[model samples]
Target: MPRSQAATIRESLSAQIDSGLLPLGSKLPSERELSELFSTTRITIKDALLALEAEGRIYREDRRGWFVSPPRLIYNPQYRSHFHDMVTRQQRQVETRVLSASTVLATPALSQELSLGPLAQLLQIRRTRSIDGRVVMYVEHHLKPEFFPGILQQDLSQSLTLIYQQRYDIRYGRSRFDIFPSAARGEVAQALTLAEGSPILLVFRINYDQHGRIIDCDHEYWRHDAIRITVDSHVAAGE
Candidate 1:
């Protein structure tokens, strides 16, 4: 049995990355260049690149070519700390951009989920988050307007949790999370600089105050390779 060309190329690139020859965030060579260098077809180069991407060693930014990936951020949905604090603690740069805001009429399902009035309108905020200069997460937030007056006038690039606490004296007491694998599409794909149908991680979360009243909900879409989820449980298995 002979080693496939794609496998050889994949291993060669991986070794370079491991040795720091291809440093983190360094863009990989064009497919044509790789094919010429490897004495292989462009399709073979594509195969190897895709394999490396799946392994989290490399990632492609749409129209920008592929690049070595940064260290994956550890994510704990159950952790109460806000994202800005967490990133600062880890010594990594994180940036949040508030893309847009609008009000939308809540349907019966959304009204029930967030306990809004029958005719209530929810304020929707769209944001994108970047880690170490690479855009990695796109979030859509829905909030009740009555909870935070003048919220839109604040510097929205800051953490929402911090804003809620400082301005409204509200805190995130309880959270419900639903995590799942998803595919990047439409606005999320554009925000992430990823091609449509790229693998993604979606987190749907609802936050409530101490008294069980809904505060807000978020739809977070993360680059599949950008996060490593960790959950610490107090109870042992099969308790």
Candidate 2:
């Protein structure tokens, strides 16, 4: 009986969301409020909410209530575009919050990937990105410090692609990419406001400079439902 009630509640809320009654990024009624309104228990309300979450209709934050999910951002890996420009073209607000930036030594795996020595210094930058005011991606980038001088002094929140081009006269060239689903944990989970073991889509990028030398690598962790990866056959110029 409770499951049926939960289903009915989930359907009702989903319809509200689809009809724009709840609106994207808008918070839903508190569980207590929902329970009282539906004459049901909090557990029943939670079941409905979880169902809605699983369907990607809504999402919750730690201690924060649920909110309507925005439309999934369409991402085409074949298109060589900056994050800011891409989000702007989609007509959604985008924000990049720099969590930390510092110089660090490259790990063995990274050294092998970038063809650098074990002790090579790298510029490590960590950021959390938001779409429509909802945090969705946590990215960690490791750049060869020698490639761009004075980059650490520049604004880290802006598009690093632009920074690489305009500041250092560097343009992206051929790249290798990898994508897979990963379990959100630790810092990535905390940045995206997801539970420790929540599912996330992980994207790895190995970028090169116009001169054919490796420049940087990025580790992108996205909320599973926040983006849709669609890559057509059209080869991008730099790819």
Candidate 3:
């Protein structure tokens, strides 16, 4: 038997995207236009588009039509590189928007994580980072206020590492990172424009000084398909 109309349309569109005829990041035609072009019903067109989206060949944005999925950015966990530098090095544009910044009382969890006293004041910073006009990461950073006095007055959108070195003469000595696959829920899901329970990468990080003092802590949530992490291994001659 011949394939269904929806399947045929899906395969045709998939071929166009694969051949670069559609081009990555290019918006697909409207559903109405597609239905007419294929001489099919709207139901068939909708099924075709949904199938493409589920296969990761395309994505939908609010108020925008479907677009071809872009390639993921390559990331190396061992590199202590800033987000701006790493993205631009790959020839991609990156934008950091400081969502909010304020001083808040440290809750028990925040206090223990940052090695601060209970009820101590901490600087809370939230930011959203996007690449090529696609939002890929949401971050929350907490810092002990005493370490960098008047830090709230500085532009928090700049590199935090630079601020630590220039303003406080502090340097990153060692760090701890915890990364895991998790489901995006609540605000994290909304920020990434995904439905609740979408798969995402959750990261917890702590930066420390030479004396083992905690400099800052961070919570980052990333789009699952937007990052490709790499790790390298080398053997010692003596071993």
Candidates' C-alpha lDDT: 0.90, 0.88, 0.83
Write down the TM-score for model 1: 0.91
- The predicted structure with the larger TM-score, 1 or 2, is 1
lDDT by residue (tens digit), candidate 1, 193-229? 9998888899999999877788899999999888898
Name the regions of candidate 3 deviating beyond 4 angstroms: 1-13, 30-56, 235-239
Candidate that would win on lDDT: 1
Q: What is the C-alpha lDDT profile of model 2 across 48-104, one tens digit per residue?
A: 998887777788877787888889999976557788999899999999999999999
Question: Which pairs of residues have clashing backbones in candidate 3?
Answer: none
RMSD of 1: 2.5
- TM-scores of the candidates in the order shown: 0.91, 0.86, 0.78
lDDT of 3 by residue, 1-239 (tens): 99988999999999998899999989999999999999989999999987887666777655567788888888765556576888999999998888889998878987887777656988999988899999988998998877889887889888887888889998877678899988778878777787667567888888887677887888999876688887564522222
lDDT of 1 at 98: 91
What lDDT, from 0 to 1, does candidate 2 have?
0.88
Count backbone overlaps in model 1: 0
128: Cα error in model 3, Å: 1.1
Winning model by TM-score: 1
TM-score ranking, high to low: 1, 2, 3
